[model samples]
Target: MSETILLVGHGSRAANGNREIEQFVQSWRERQPAWRIEVCFIEFAEPLLDAGLTRAAQDARRVIVVPLILNAAGHAKMEIPAHIAAARLRHPATEFVYARHLGAVEPVLHILERTLRRAMLALDAPDPKTTGVILLGRGSSDRVANGEVAKMARWLHEETSHELVDIAFTGITHPRLETVVQRHSRIGMTQVVVLPYYLFTGTLIERIQRQIAHLRQQYPLLRFGLGGHFGFEEEIFGLLDERVRAARADGTARAEHMMECDGCKYRGLAEPHESHHHDHAHTHAREVPA
Candidate 1:
C-alpha cells in the first residue's frame, strides 16, 4: 500500500507566509523522500485543503492530513475535519487520517523556555527569576482553546524561574496584553517578558509588539522584552513527523488526546461550536528566518 503525507497549513493572505509553509514541507520531503508528500492551505493560498486531499487520494491508499496549527483551536477541531469529510465523499475508497494540533507540548516547552532565557540574557536583566513572563497567543473565541493557553502559562511557570507567568491575547479575548502589563506593573514586577506562542509571523505578532512598545513607553520604570517566536525550525518538523507517524498507525488524523466532535465549530454550527475564523487573516507582522 502506498503512503502519502498531506501538510495542511492555515493559509495566509501574505504570499510570504504561505511560502514559509511550503518551504517547511519541502524540507520534510528532503528528509523522507520515500513517501508521497503534498502541501495545502485551509484558506488564502493556492492548492486548498479540498484540492490537496483530492490529489493525495489519487495514488495513495492511506492519506494523512497533518494540520499545521499551534493549538486545538477552531481550525483543528472544525475546519480541517469538515474538509476531510468532504474529501471522503469525493473519494470514498480513500482513507483520510487527522492528527492533533501543535500545542505547547513538552518539546515546544523546552524550546520556549530556552528562548525566554536567551531573551532575558540579551536584555542584561538583573534578575531573570523575578521577571514576569507573558505567553501571548492568537486568542481564540473558543473557551477551550483559550484555556489551553492559560494552562501553558502554568506549565511555563513551573518549568522556569519566572516570578509570575501570565497569558494574553492579540484579539477577541479578555486580559489583553495592555491589561496584563498594567496589572503586573502596579504589582511591582520590574521586568516582563512576552513570548509569542506562534509558529510563523503574522499580524497578531505585530499587534503584540506594538502593544508592548506602547506599554514600555507608558511604564518607563519597568523593563519589557519580547521573546523569539516558535518558527518552522528543526523541532517543528520533528513534531509533525511524529504526528504523521501516529496518524499512519491510527488510520486517521483525529488524535486520541484531541476532543471529539464533528459538524461543530469548524463547520460553523449555531450552538456548541469549537472553532473561530482568523486562519487566513495572517498578515506579516514578524519574520522568522527559513
Candidate 2:
C-alpha cells in the first residue's frame, strides 16, 4: 500500500530550532526516498498539524503520524492525537496510524553517553567517578513522563563511570537545574556537568545556558559545564525508522521499547473537547520540550 509519514515536531519559538527540525526531516526524506514524508509543527511554526496532515493524506492509502518528540508528554498524549483524530474524520478513506514518541530507549542512552563524554573531554574534566553529572530535561507536569527522565539518570549512572548522577528539569517541576546545582555544590563536587536532554535548541535550552551562567557566578569555587543537546545522530534516525516500522506493522505504534499509553491521563481521549484549547499553555516560561 502507498504510505505517507507525517512527522510532527514539537514546535519552538526559536527559529533555529524549528529549522533544525525541518532540516532533520529533509535529511530523512533524502535518506528514505520511498516514503513520502511530510513535516509539520504543533505550534510556533508554519504548516501546523492539521494543514500538514491534510497535505500528507492527499494521495496515500495509509498515513503514519510519527511524533518527533523525546518523551510522550502532553503534546504526544493529547494534542497530536486529537489533531490526528480530526484528520481521520476529514479523510475517511485514508488510514491514520499514531506512532510512538522517540522514547527513553537504550539507543538514546548511548547517544547521551557520547554527548556527555564529548562535553567532559572539552572541559578537561576529572574522573567520571568523582565528577557530578546532572541530566537536564525539559520538565513536564506529567509525573509519568518526568519519571522517564529520572529513569534515564539512573540508567546513566549504571552504564557510565559517573557515581554522582542527578536529574533536573528546566521548568514546571521541582529540582530545577539550580536546585541540583546547589545540592551538587553543597556536596563539594568540584566539577559538574549539565547535559541538556533535548534533540534541538529551543527557548528552554537558551534559558538553561543563562541559568548555567548565573550558576557559575553563584558557585565560584565549583566548576560548571553545559553539554550538547541530542542533535542529529544515527541512533536517533534509527529510532525514528523503528517507529515507522512499528506503525506499519500494527498501526498503533506499539513497540516493546516504547512507553505504554495506559499511564497517560489523556490516553483514549481524542475528541477535540473544549479542554483541548486548555491543553497546557506552552508559553515561553511554561513550555517543556520533548
Candidate 3:
C-alpha cells in the first residue's frame, strides 16, 4: 500500500490564500514523484480534511498529515486533532500519523535569507555585511509561539553575515513594527530592511505594508524595503519529505516498542500486510535529493 501525505493549511476566507496552498502542494508533488500527495484546508475552503483524507486513503494503508501552520496554537493543537479524529472514526482501518508544523526549520530560514538578499540587491545596498535585518512574524498570544520568532532571528544573525538581526511583530506582542523601526532609526542604522516572515498575502501583510510605507515617510534617511513572503521554494518540498519520514519512523518505533512491552490495542497497527509491506517500503524510497 502506498503512503499518502495530506498537506493541510489554515484555510483563509480569501481566494488567493487557498491558491497559495494548492500551488505549494503542486510544487512539492513534482519533487516527490513516487509518493502520493494532496492539499487540504482546515476551514473556509472546499475539499476539507475529511474529504481529502478519504480520497488519499483509498489505496493507501498509512497516511501522514502535515500542518503548514507556523505555531502550535488552538488550531494546531485542538482543531486539527479534532478533524483527524473525525477522519479516523470514518475510516478506522487506515493508519494515520501527524507531523509537526512548519516552524522555523532550516529550509525556511534559507528561504528568508534568500528573500532578504534579493531585497538588499534591489535597494542597491553595497554591503550585506553592514546591513541589518528586522525579521517580522505574525505574533501570537502564546509565549512559546512568540519565542519561535525570536529564535529564528537569533539563528539568522549567527548564520548570516548581517550586522544585526531583530524580530518584531504586527500583532499580539512587542516590539511592534513601528517601535522597532523607530529604535533602529535612533541608532542611525539607515540601511535597515523589514522582512515579512509570512507564507502568503493576507490582511496582516497589507497592514505590514502600510506600516512600512509610514516608516519610510517618517524616517526619510533610513532605507526600508518589504521582503516577499515564503513562496514556491524547492527546499520546502525537501523539508516536507523529511518531516514525513521522521513521523513515520517515530510512529513505527512507538508501535513496535508498545507491542513488546504492554501488548497495547494499537499493537496491530505496527504489523504490515504481507502484500502491502513491499509497496509501503517503496513509497518511502524516494527521498529529496541533497
Clashing pairs in 2: none
In Å, residue 115's CA in model 3 sits off its true spot by 1.9
At residue 263, candidate 3 shows an lDDT of: 21
Which pairs of residues clash in candidate 3, taking residues 3 or more apart in a chain or in different chains?
none
Model 1 misplaced stretches (Cα beyond 4 Å): 253-257, 260-290
Clashes of each: 9, 0, 0
Of 1 and 3, the candidate ranking higher by TM-score: 1
lDDT of 1 by residue, 94-194 (tens): 88777777765787787788888888987795585668898887777666667777878888898877778999887767788888888888888889889
For each candidate in turn, the TM-score is 0.85, 0.90, 0.80
The C-alpha lDDT values of all candidates are 0.74, 0.81, 0.70
True-structure lDDT of candidate 2: 0.81
lDDT, candidate 3, equals 0.70
> TM-score: which candidate is best?
2
